[model samples]
Structures are given as structure tokens and as C-alpha cells.
Target: MFTQRSRCLLLIFLLYFVNKISSKVEFTNIKCNTFDPDFASFEYCFLKSVNRTYKYLSIKVNLHKTPITKVKVNIAIFKRYNGYKPFLYNITKDACKFLLLKNPDPVSNYIYNGFKSFTNMNHTCPFEVSPQKLPIGYINQQVTDVLPVPHGDYLFHSNWMAYDIKRATVNVYFTIS
Candidate 1:
């Protein structure tokens, strides 16, 4: 007894949940040493987590030898088709200028933002955390920010934060969509 629009919406919603349950994230292997060059580019370092039922992507950047001030990360989520496709929307800089301009540590940023759910309709990172940092390290496996991504095959790319910097790893946990 559902209307056509309601049925369509329900189907879409079900498909979204199905993709979330079945989707997997795979990360490329990255080897890093303290003496590695600054701003090194590493390939196959994207994230891929599969069959996860969570509702948030937990991004953790662990910093050991590398200082937090000397790290930076640029993350982009791309959709997978025959080839990888980038998300259509541009991340709003002003919406999260507080984190981008101020450069607060990851823990403080998460605390400031609080635990708010990120859905398909809402893709903005909270004011406390921005996607990229001039220099970044050690998020302590916290929910740094809400990723603007939907279910299905998507590539998670990070720059500067996932390379040869001693003991630094960028970990992203995607929640169920």
C-alpha cells in the first residue's frame, strides 16, 4: 500500500544499507622511515574497510617520531565505476575554517565537534576538524570528522599524513550508510 515515491525511497534506503553492510575498504601498504623526505607521495595508501556495520568512519593518525606540527593530510573520497571518480562537490573551506586556520590537535578538535552523525545529506566536517592540515599527526583513532561519502565502492585518499614519517598511519573507519 505504498505510493510510488515512498516505494522508491524505501528501495533506495534499503540499497544504501545493503551497500554499507557489504562494502569493504582496502588500504595500500605504506612503508615509512624517519629519514624519508618531507611531503613524500605514496601510492596504494587509500582506505578500504569491508563488511563493516558501523555508523562513523574512525580516522586515526598515529604520530611517533614525527611531530604533529610537521604533518599534513589531504583526503579525498572518490566513487568507483569502470574507473575511479571523484566526488562532485567541493569541500567548503569556510564551513570549517576554525580547524583549517587554527590547526588544533585531533583530540581537541573531536572534543569540540562532539559526536554528531554524518549522513548523505550532511557532508560538512564539523568546525573542530577539517579534512586537511598544513602539518598533521596522531588523531588517536578518534572520529576526526564526518566524511562526505555514500555507500558502494569509493576510494579514500590521503596525502602527507600516510607516508614515510617514522610511525605514522592514517586509519579511516567508515560507518554504515
Candidate 2:
């Protein structure tokens, strides 16, 4: 029989591998870039594309709450040709990450944005799965909201710390098509 510590270690190892295998990488639309002057103060904003084939925006959550209750998310999108046309998509929290509140209220006073790559290099392209080192700009966000990315571009905003979660990393994987 395995010892308690051994079992715990095994569980942790399994969870780590499971998280990696399950994580999906989604490419961001570089053209639809926006700067959220309100939230992070000139922070870069990206509208990521999502679909059934390319679903799952993997985000890591660091939590201080013994058991997290729910996560809140804000979402926005951009029109392809409208020049910052405001669009929105509904995100469903994936069970792979954590459960979300049944009734999630939208957040104001914050604009969502992040890093996106239009080119894919064998070394570094997908922001989350790339083996190459990430530059100063490509950083992960805290507790994020979820939704099936629409056929267009979208922006997301959330505070992981709201649920007592902090210091987390998020990775989004794309399906090879």
C-alpha cells in the first residue's frame, strides 16, 4: 500500500499532468488591440477568439479562501472593421478550472485586455504553450470569467482576488486545425 504522503504526491503529479493535457491554447487577434486606461492604466487589451474546436482559456488561480465559492467575469469584444466596435460574448466557466457563480454580475470600471500573437513560430507563438521565454508584456491574469468565444474577437475582465484567489497564471491552448 502507498503511504499517505506518497498518495498525496501521486495525486499532485496526476493533477499537474491533467491540467497540462486539458489546457487549450487560443490565438489572440492582434489587430483588435485596446488600452484600458481605467483598470491597469494603459494596460494592453486583447480580444481572444473562441469556438467549439478552440475552446478553453486556461487560467491559473491562486486562492486564499479555504474553498472558493464563485468567480466573476466581464467580457467585451471588438468589430473586425468598425475600429474598436464594442461587442460582447457570454463565457461559460469550464469545469477544468473552477466553478463559477450561478448568477454572475458584470463588472464595470474595468476594460479587459491581454497578449495575443498573430504569427506562430515553432519556438514561440501560442502565448501559453510556447516553450520560449515570454517577454515583459505577456503576463497572466488572476481569476477570469469564461464563455464560448464567438465567431469574432472578444475582451475579458475579472478579479480572481474577489473570491480570495491571487497570484495565478492562465494559459489558453488552441486545437491544431
Candidate 3:
């Protein structure tokens, strides 16, 4: 049903449209079947909850093997574990990624707010009362790290607080390996 000219134009349009989207890769099917956990919020532009820990938050990125060059992630604590407030403690910098590891003492920009300190996510030292300051909720490519984790339905909380707020957000950005 197409005239020669019309057919040519349609073909060109289709080719252009295909070409426009061919180079992008979206890993958006964020089901637990795709990730370790079956329950994750797909509200982020790109988000996945793969932990570096075998049992919990152990995630690995192949910065050396793929186009992903580098990654910078921050871990933030929340007012409550699963209820995101969207504003108050939304951390805009790197914090908890250091505490989640085995020996995250090298990262000077973090605090180990005790995991039990859910009411106050601000414990800079003593590393005991501050569970958020532990590396259990962190991921880093720095010198030697350990992926500490717990089992089943654990949400990684933020351990960093540069302001007077209580909510937090741990962010990771990478340039595909």
C-alpha cells in the first residue's frame, strides 16, 4: 500500500529510530530473580542491590573489564529502615561505604553510627554505638575491603551525616566497566 517515495521515507525513519536507541543498555528488570533480593524499589535511574557479602550486601563491579571506568557511592542512614522520607537525611556524599567493610578505618569521611542506634544515625567514633558506620552497608574499590552482611530482608542504611538531618541516602555512580 506504499508509494515508492513513501516507502523509502518510512524505511529511513525506522532506521533512524532504531539507530538512536541501539547504543543504550538498560538493566531495568529489577526483580529478585534479576538481583539477590526479590524486593527492590525501581525508582532510581539505575539501581541494583547486589552485595559484596555472600549472604548480604556484597556487590561486585567489573571496572577493569567493561566500559564502566569508575564508581563513587555514598551510604546514608534513614529515619526508619524501609520507609524512605525523600528529603531530610538524603545524603549527597559518600559515607557508609567505608563502614560496611572489614577494616574501613582508612576512609576518613565516615562515622560508624551503631546499627542499633536507629533513632540517632549519628555516631562518629567509638565505632560501637554506630552500626551505620560499619562497612556492612558499604561498597568500595579502595585498598582491601570486606563485605559484611546479615540475612534476609536487610536494607542497607547510611552511616554518614554532614548535616543536622536524620534521613540518609547511599549513592553509587559508575562509568561502565
Candidate 4:
């Protein structure tokens, strides 16, 4: 036995809970471009789908120069509206310094944690690029832990820089449903 206002409030709460529980994040596409081929080159960069429900992103970069002492990464997120417009997140971080942190910033930590398990860039300064292609991906894993955002298409754009020079850019497209 509930009043009208109480029933309406309960229904709203249930709807919110259901929406939160059913939300999922999936990678739709990825694009990579190198600004300086002499410094670095993309070996492979693409989104891979294993099945209808499973997909992953894979990327590899071959660095011509060795012992990269300084590295920085810029990340920006965009949501599709009339076109693509900037969303909530835009971050810039020194890669080496961030790797050394015991407890990093929340935003950077969230982004790093998402791909840390699949990346070889876990160590601090003086990175020696190996001859082999370094693959970074979340194989067979669906991204569940993510920022709470409305269901929409998103673009995660990142710039990889080394030695104060922009080396490459990666654009990852995803959808939340």
C-alpha cells in the first residue's frame, strides 16, 4: 500500500538502477597516425572483433629511436552530438612520472588502469624500444569499469609525445549502451 508520490519515486529509482546495471562499454573502432615516421611508425592499429559480443583493440608502434628519456600523453574525450563535441575529460600527463606514482591522480589512474594490463609501457624513464612490435590491447575483455555517462558514442583521442615532439596520435571510438 503506497501513495501516488511514493509509487512514482520508487519507479524512478528502479529505472535508474536498471539502467546502471545494464550499461556496457564496447570498442567500435580505432585509428592511429604517426607524425614522424623517422621517429616512430605504427606497425598495426585496429579494432578486432572475435564474435558478435566480444571485441578488442590492438595497436603496435615501432620506435626507430632508442632510450626514450621523456614521454607525455594527452587525452581528450568527445561525444557525438550534431557532430563530435568535447565531452568531460581532457588530460595531459607525463608518462614516466605517472608510472612511478604509488597513487596517481584519479582521472589519469582511471585511464591507465583500463589498459595497463595490456601495455608494455609500464616502466619509468629511459625506455628502450625493442625491435619487435609491442602489442597493447584488452583481449577478450569487456570494459565494465568506466565513467558513468549517458548512453552515447564517444571518441577517445590521445597524442603520444617523446622528447617534447609529438610522435603519434590514436583515436578510439566506442559506444555505451
Candidate 5:
């Protein structure tokens, strides 16, 4: 008979499930091509050998002369290559190496040049994730940061608002064996 409010609701549900598994962070998600960029196979899902995997890729652009102001699109994550690798490989591999988070630091070469960058709109290219030198605050509109992705296919380039510059390209594919 476990009484006393059922042991305080099982100790607050085991401390909220162990603090959500100790602040869980490790990703592999490539979604946001619900097709509409003049769909014609939408350019074959922004092909590049077509195989968009992921591990921490977030892009949200919607700012055309203000109102919903959002501008946070500069995520470069890659690890393996041609064969692909590292997408939630259990998170620990240095938390998915790659960091250039928030505040005045997001533009790993090329944007507004060649299909508005994001590595030429998501294409499983670029091998080597050691691009870090960012440290502080300039992504505005709804803060959310944790850019640590490495292992394979990575290219996140977006023009998510900041005066009106349309572009979206997020192709995160990672794997580690």
C-alpha cells in the first residue's frame, strides 16, 4: 500500500525521468522538405547523392520586412563521407564535435553566393568538422543554440529572416562506426 500521495508521485516521476536523461543532446534529423519549392521532385530532395541524415540541424526562416522576425541559419555539421555516418551514434562522440554557436558568429563561408549557400542547398559534400570560433549573441528572434554536429553530410544554410532574404537548405547526415 504505497500511500503519502503515492510516494510524492513517485518522487516527482523519478525526478522528471532523470532530468530528461541528463539533458539529452545528440541528433540526426533531416526534415523540412514537405515539397513546395516549385516541386518537381523538389529538385530531388536537394540531391547530392540523396541521403540526408542529421545530428543537430535546426533552421527557421520567416522574416519579410518584419513580423515573426527570425534569423538563425548557419549550421555546419559533417563527419563521414560517400558512405555516410554519424546520426545519433549515441551522442557521446565529443557531443558531435562542431561548435560556432550564438552571438555574432554564423557564416561558415558562402551565402548570397551560389544558391544562397547552406552548402549549395543541402548536398552530402564536405568532410571534416573542425570549424569552431564563435562565442556569443546574434541570432535573434526566439533563441535556441547547440551547434555540435560532425560525422558526415552537413550543410545548413538559411535566410530565416533579417530584412528579407529567402533561402533554406538543411541537409544534415551523420554516422560514426
Candidate 6:
């Protein structure tokens, strides 16, 4: 404990650990499309940057038809290596049932936890239009804590379907560093 070399080594190790824990996830871009505008349409979807280190996601969807009885969502994540390739997760869930669960599947719960606080689609189905926008304020540390990946580029793709018909698709591009 008195040796200068040992102290230096310990300091270096602490710094590395701190940096690893403080790593952040940043939104690079977002793309959204509505296949059938009569059912639903995107009002706006984009990433906002306040500074080099601060960025947030903002998206809004207008539901033209109210009280959609049944809805399903398909989510897939990809990591970039030369080009985007499938990474860890690919799941499809019944939106209504998933939302009402007491404890959902681990993977779905992990992913949904990231945006649950920021979106309005919280309760079970019979979903209706919301006048306000869905602003996913920021990607917080809670999300990073559950992520089991190194620094890299990732894509989160989601397809929304209602009554067994494809309705919309959203692609979110982000980087963890």
C-alpha cells in the first residue's frame, strides 16, 4: 500500500472502471413510415441534439382510428459490422397483453423499460389517439445498465401491426460509446 507503483496501478484500474460504467448511448438518427395513413400516421419522428454530448429522441403518431382492439409489435436489433447484422434480440409481442403483464419476459422487459416512462402507450389495449407527442426524453443510464454490449453502432427496428395487417415501421439508429 505504500509503494508508488501500486498506487498508480490502482488509480489506473479505478479510472478504467469508472469510464466503463459511465459510457453513454447516443441517438444517431430515426426513420418512420406509415403504410396506411387511414389507420395511423406519424406526425413527426426525429432526433434532437442540444450539444455534442446531449441528444434526445422525439416522435409522434396520430391514431386516426380510435380504440384499436388488437395490436402487435415486432422488434429486432442489429449491430453494425461492415454492415448491420442481427445482434441479440428479435421478438414479437401482442401489445395489449404485454402491457398488462405483471412481469413480462426478460428481453422484452429490458427493452421496454428504456422507453416506458417517455411514451403514452402504457396501459392495455383499446388505444386511442393522443393529442400530445411521444417524446422519449433521453436514453438514460438505466438502459445502459442492462445492456450487455461493448461500444458499437446499433439499430432498433420495430414494426407495428393491428388486426394482423402491417401498419407502420420505425428504425432507430444509435451508438453506444
TM-score of every model versus the real structure? 0.32, 0.25, 0.22, 0.80, 0.22, 0.81
* Backbone steric clashes in candidate 5, count: 20
Per-model CA lDDT versus the true structure: 0.36, 0.31, 0.30, 0.75, 0.30, 0.79
**Residues 112-140 of candidate 1: C-alpha lDDT, one tens digit per residue:** 34323321212333212222211111221
- Superior candidate under TM-score, 1 versus 6: 6
Could you say which candidate leads in TM-score? 6
> Residue 45, candidate 1: how far off, in angstroms?
12
Which of 3 and 4 is the better model by lDDT?
4
- Look at candidate 5 and tell me the lDDT of residue 162: 20
Ranking by lDDT: 6, 4, 1, 2, 3, 5
Candidate 4 local distance difference test against the native: 0.75
| After superposition, candidate 1 runs with Cα above 4 Å error | 1-62, 89-151, 161-177
1 against 2, candidate with superior TM-score:
1
Candidate 6's displacement at residue 177, Å, is 1.6
Q: What tens-digit string does per-residue lDDT give for candidate 3 at 90-177?
A: 3343334443455655323333332223323243322211122223223322111222222112233433222233222333221111
Cα error, candidate 3, residue 120 (Å): 29
For model 4, residues 100-177, the per-residue Cα lDDT tens digits are 999999888887766776667667886632212212224212233344567888898999899889988999888877
**Residue runs of model 5 more than 4 Å from their true location after superposition:** 1-4, 7-9, 16-159, 168-177
Per-residue lDDT for 1-177 in model 5, tens only?
899999999999996765443222223344443222421112223212222332223333222222222233344333445643333221111111222222322333222221222322332112211112111121110112233222234323222212233344445332221
Candidate 3 has an lDDT of 0.30
How do all the candidates rank in terms of TM-score, highest first? 6, 4, 1, 2, 5, 3
- Residue 15 of candidate 4: its Cα lDDT? 74
Candidate 6 lDDT by residue in tens digits, 1-177: 469999999999996886677456777788999999999988888777766756677778988887798999999999999999998999999989998899999899988877777677778888742223223334547545555466799999999999999999999998877
TM-score of candidate 3 versus the correct structure, residues matched by position: 0.22
